[model samples]
Target: MAISLGLFSSLLSPRETSTLTFTKPSPSSSALRMVRTVTSSTVSHSGPSKIRGIMKPRKVSPEMAALVGAHEISRTQVLKLIWAYIKDNNLQDPEDKRTINCDEKLKKVFQGKDRVGMLEVARLISPHFLKSES
Candidate 1:
């Protein structure tokens, strides 16, 4: 009988595996690179920051008046009440979770926005609040 050495030799060979290697950069160089990256990012973001619109309460129109009633409240509150009404009446879209199916009242508040995401609720509703008397 011939002894088989193939299996033994295979076991002796190193198994194939993947490895990730990272080289440590000098402390000063690493710090400089980090500073440069941060500076560039900030500069890029600065333009959008200037374009931001002021968050002032806008005058409530007749349509908005009916939805929120005759009262002054923060835009956040208006959105909360609107969501509450939607929940109570089951106006949420069945097919898409993010879409809101507006009833008559919500349709007015949403300004004909047939489908709205949860995130845009606050932004879209902000225009409905009564602007402060100045």
Candidate 2:
């Protein structure tokens, strides 16, 4: 009879190595038992899964200079910066919170529109970003 065993370790250096031995049961022994062991030198560190999407930074246009300036930035970061600007400037409509009143700089980004809705802000901001050539 033959038994197969598998082992895995994530440590760079282990001061002591633990050995595992498997023994065959005697004919007289009727009860069945199993033992499993895991040895490690350090605790593993794992964080949350990363967001999935194209995370490359895109070029910012002149209209978006007030928010992200001319430097390249990710779409998610651009949205966050825009929202921060809106909140800081108190541009969101009081009656219709979904609507945002455009300031001078935002007016250019919004295509001269005096006001725009939250859902449509991304669409308006899209044109201001271009794929940066490597």
Candidate 3:
């Protein structure tokens, strides 16, 4: 069966309708029925939960700090912030979005390359992520 992501997403929202029912083992036993209602207010508002070995913060290299500023950031957050910076500066090629043009600041992170392909970005940024300290 084919699943439509849009349909699935709509159905999974906390506001979506759903019901749960359970019968007591013994009516005279005074067993109580427990029910938890689903609603936006009942859902967790916290940010992403920690994954044991993932999302660890790494020291930012001096070169990269010049662009995104000096701070400890997770690899995922670093990539996201870099992409935001690139978009804010309109550094992506107009004709080919996959090609990122390096500005003066970005040139430092990209190791002075005038332009780099989207696939090469991760490899270029890898060195900037320092090994996590125990």
| Candidate 3, residue 47: lDDT | 94
Per lDDT, the best of the predicted structures is 3
Candidate 2, pairs of clashing residues = none
**1 or 3, greater by TM-score:** 3
Writing each residue's lDDT as its tens digit, candidate 1 over 16-134 gives: 22222334456666632211111121223334443223433345767776777745545555666787888889887888778888777777777787778877787877666555676
Candidate 3 positional error at 54, Å: 4.9
Runs with alpha carbons beyond 4 Å of true place in candidate 3: 1-54
Q: Give me the overall lDDT of model 1.
A: 0.60
TM-score of each: 0.50, 0.58, 0.59
Best by TM-score: 3
Ranking by TM-score: 3, 2, 1
Candidate-wise lDDT, in order: 0.60, 0.74, 0.75
- Candidate 3 similarity to native, TM-score: 0.59
| TM-score winner, 1 or 2 | 2
Q: What value does the lDDT take at residue 4 in candidate 1?
A: 22
Across residues 31-112, which tens digit of lDDT does each residue of candidate 2 receive?
A: 5444445455465548766644446577788668666664777788888889988999999999999999999878888899
Candidate with more favorable, higher lDDT: 1 or 2: 2
